[model samples]
Target: MSFHKYIFHYRFSGKSDKPLILFLHGFMGNIHEFDEAISLLTDEFYCLNIDLPGHGKTKILDDDCYKMPKIADALINLLNELQIERCFLIGYSMGGRLALYLTLKFPQRFHKIILESASPGLITDRERLERVKRDEQIARKLARSVEKDDFRKFLDNWYNQQIFGNIKNHPHFEQMIENRLQNNPKKLAKSLQLMGTGVQPSLWDKLKENKKPILLLVGENDSKFVEINRKMFAVNQLCKLKIIKKAAHNIHLENTFIFIENIRNFF
Candidate 1:
């Protein structure tokens, strides 16, 4: 309950009187991922970017901290420590999933929520099992890479996935890789084991229960998530879906200008 007990590294920017915008980065990403967006929106909102557990400067104390709900709890504690009663949230990919979980569990804490390329977890038990297996395989590979002290290969394979095809060729590609490489492989592997979509509880049934306005952003090129969000929108009229043109999984990075514009319009 007390967030001060956790040592999450965070950066708060902009005027205190402005509405707060909490930015959550995806896996293998740090708080700096939102630097560009934060810079543009600082005049209007106070941006609080935190490095999630197992990634960035935040160190994981217990293995259980990597679980989805626990991560959400930590965020709640963070808000308490920052004295933020309520704030807008923007999460990218893995962080978006976590954001959804948080909103589902603590709806009153958020004003508006934006999810980029996130899902509500696997629906059926069979689908969940399959996803768990796939995630386990990837986690094992990451663990092996960590043992060998070669996280670069893990990152290379991760970014090489078809979903991120649009990002690999971008000019910031090298810098992105470098930023991911800074993460501790062992913690990241543990994170995948605990917080992976396969292990997290499905929120499909809870979608209609969400009262706060939700914006679901997906890249046009990321067909998988686009379809997922489409289905999500169909089920929840409160949710709105926006497709980023020519962008893939990481829309904030792939098409930042449009991404910021979308956020501005949404807010």
Candidate 2:
């Protein structure tokens, strides 16, 4: 529905009386990103999932909406429109970064937060500039992959990243790719260019100041994020880090049961 400058595609499930958990998907992911996890959690929590700008059916009225701060404001506006005073949050990858921003920027609006395979963004200007260039190249590739077969090829190459570990071997890997194919490559490219990690302000400095209960979930196989979360835990006394065994970057998809178990225990 219409939420100020953006038209969002969102889904609400479970009983309204239950504690609400707002889920934000990763880059290239849609509102259904947490479907499997949400299915199991409906008995305990109400869920709200939405397609962020430049992904799924959500339409952005202004290009400025692609910026992280603007997106955060849009989300807060959405929460107000829904009459949700405070709620739990679960964010994966890009969403996790945004979730952290929201938590730090508007601490009173969230009760607790769960960040999976997430980071606080790059710590240095040089790193951010380099990443921006790399993301630009990737965005060009995504923009060029207009055909189904081309997009499939791009998807295959994407999961091959070591950060993703052995997700390609999962039984539902093909189905996952199919669902991702529903997103428009052109718009996905726009999201990557604008909301990519390079564009987000580093939250490392703000981490030490956070007081809200925070759960950091990283896959055991995803060494990069594990180290990142470890650093995050070291800085914040209220943050808890749980490394999911045998999973990689996309823990929710790679090991749904354990992912849900962590959510149950944490939230």
TM-score of 2: 0.98
Query: 185-267, model 1: which lDDT tens digit per residue?
Result: 77788888899989998999998788889999999988899999999999888899998997999998888999999889998
Name the regions of candidate 1 deviating beyond 4 angstroms. 1-5, 147-149
Task: Write candidate 2's Cα lDDT for 74-186 as tens digits.
Answer: 89989998999999999999999999999999999999999999999999999999999999999999999999999999999998898999999999888788889999999
- C-alpha RMSD of candidate 1: 1.7
TM-score of 1: 0.95
Total backbone collisions, model 1 = 0
lDDT of 2: 0.93
What does the lDDT read for residue 158 in candidate 1?
A: 78
